[model samples]
Target: MQTASRRFDLSVQYACNKEGLPSRPQFRGWARAALEGGGQVTIRLVEAEEGQELNREYRGKDYATNVLSFPYDTEPRVFGDLVICPDVVAREAAEQGKSLEAHYAHLVVHGMLHLQGWDHEEDDSAEAMEQREREILASLGYPDPYA
Candidate 1:
């Protein structure tokens, strides 16, 4: 039998001045759809500068990308934070011909999976994660993000 998926306590923080960002409920719904167990997560919407600083400090990258997931604890519960740069998301959405909401949904799912120990570090692992992402997004009525 399948174990019950744990519920999540999610918070959305806006650290940027970007317009057209999604609301807290939207983020919560997306997170809920992706999270597989009991967890607490803070989804912080940041500007490019903060995003760049975080990437530099953590991943040794010098520029901002899209979404970053920081998982703190895992066991009976999962705790983490998801930092997302709206500027990058918007630019990527425009460039990829996808809606802003679609991109955000994809990133939220991706980050939540990371918090659950899902990774794409290897070729086979990447394929597995991508397949799972595709399934989750499709359940949420989104088209293939990789398509």
Candidate 2:
């Protein structure tokens, strides 16, 4: 398969104490699977505090989510930023009985899809978005995350 020539900027902002999470290469793999052409994206790996703060500030939710997408208003090729909470992701993986790596891959793909204009606000939209996610994840050697 031909990989797209894209540029992704991953910024890991640790607001909480954690270590040994997946690196930028792993995230780039997921982003490439979702987006095409040459463009940029920022991936911020934050802690619960910052994640919760951002969620509350922007999304009106007081809790930290696994991943939050902040797509920039630019060319469609130049996606945007994705803030990922490692603590939340780990907790969710343990609670959901999923491997950390697999969960991380799923969330990255999900966030990238959001940047690509995929939303899950409606049932049909969710189905289509999730199908795309599954296909992307499967290509990356991961099982269906929603299964």
Candidate 3:
């Protein structure tokens, strides 16, 4: 059931509890949907500690975020690494009353979108990004993460 429109390879590394994490195929689906199978992606699932450290180091934020995107090259095609914190993701999902799977899917797509130059730092950009996210998630049979 997992496939991509073009060449897609998802390299996944887990530094957290393996349970409840999506499979490689699932990630491939998300990445493919986000980039339309444009390029390669690497996703690393991390614990809260590492997530927090990375956030602080890279983003100047001391708290752990649900996901962070690092785009390496995007001219010819989208290529990047995404770091996802399962602890944060699970907490956010539970707090928001969303399914873990759906939240993860949303984050995967969100991260991929970021890699593709999508931004939400401003109101207009955020709205556009959210709309794209809703549409993409909908395509994947997931509820709107913003809704």
- Number of the predicted model whose TM-score against the real structure is largest: 1
Q: Assess candidate 1 and give its lDDT.
A: 0.92
Q: Which whole-number lDDT from 0 to 100 does residue 48 have in model 2?
A: 88
Compute each candidate's TM-score over C-alphas. 0.94, 0.88, 0.93
Q: Model 3 over residues 1-147: C-alpha lDDT tens digits?
A: 444435667799988899868998898888788885468789999999999999999999999999999999886677899999999999999999999999999999899999989999999999999999999999999998987
Please, what are the lDDT tens digits per residue for candidate 2 over residues 1-147?
423445445554545554778876777787778775655788888878899999999999999999999988445465588898998999999999999999999998898888878899999999999999999999999999999
Q: Please, what is the whole-model Cα lDDT of each candidate in the order they appear? A: 0.92, 0.83, 0.90
| Candidate 3 lDDT | 0.90
Candidates arranged by TM-score, highest first: 1, 3, 2
The per-residue C-alpha lDDT of model 3 at residue 116 equals 88
Report how far residue 93 has shifted in candidate 2, in Å: 0.4
The number of the candidate with the highest lDDT is: 1
lDDT of 3 at 41: 85
What is the Cα-based TM-score of model 3?
0.93
Encode model 1's per-residue lDDT on 33-103: one tens digit a residue: 88777888999999999999999999999999899999998677789999999999999999999999999
| Model with the higher TM-score, candidate 2 or 3 | 3
Task: Give the runs in model 3 whose Cα sits over 4 Å from its true position.
Answer: 1-5
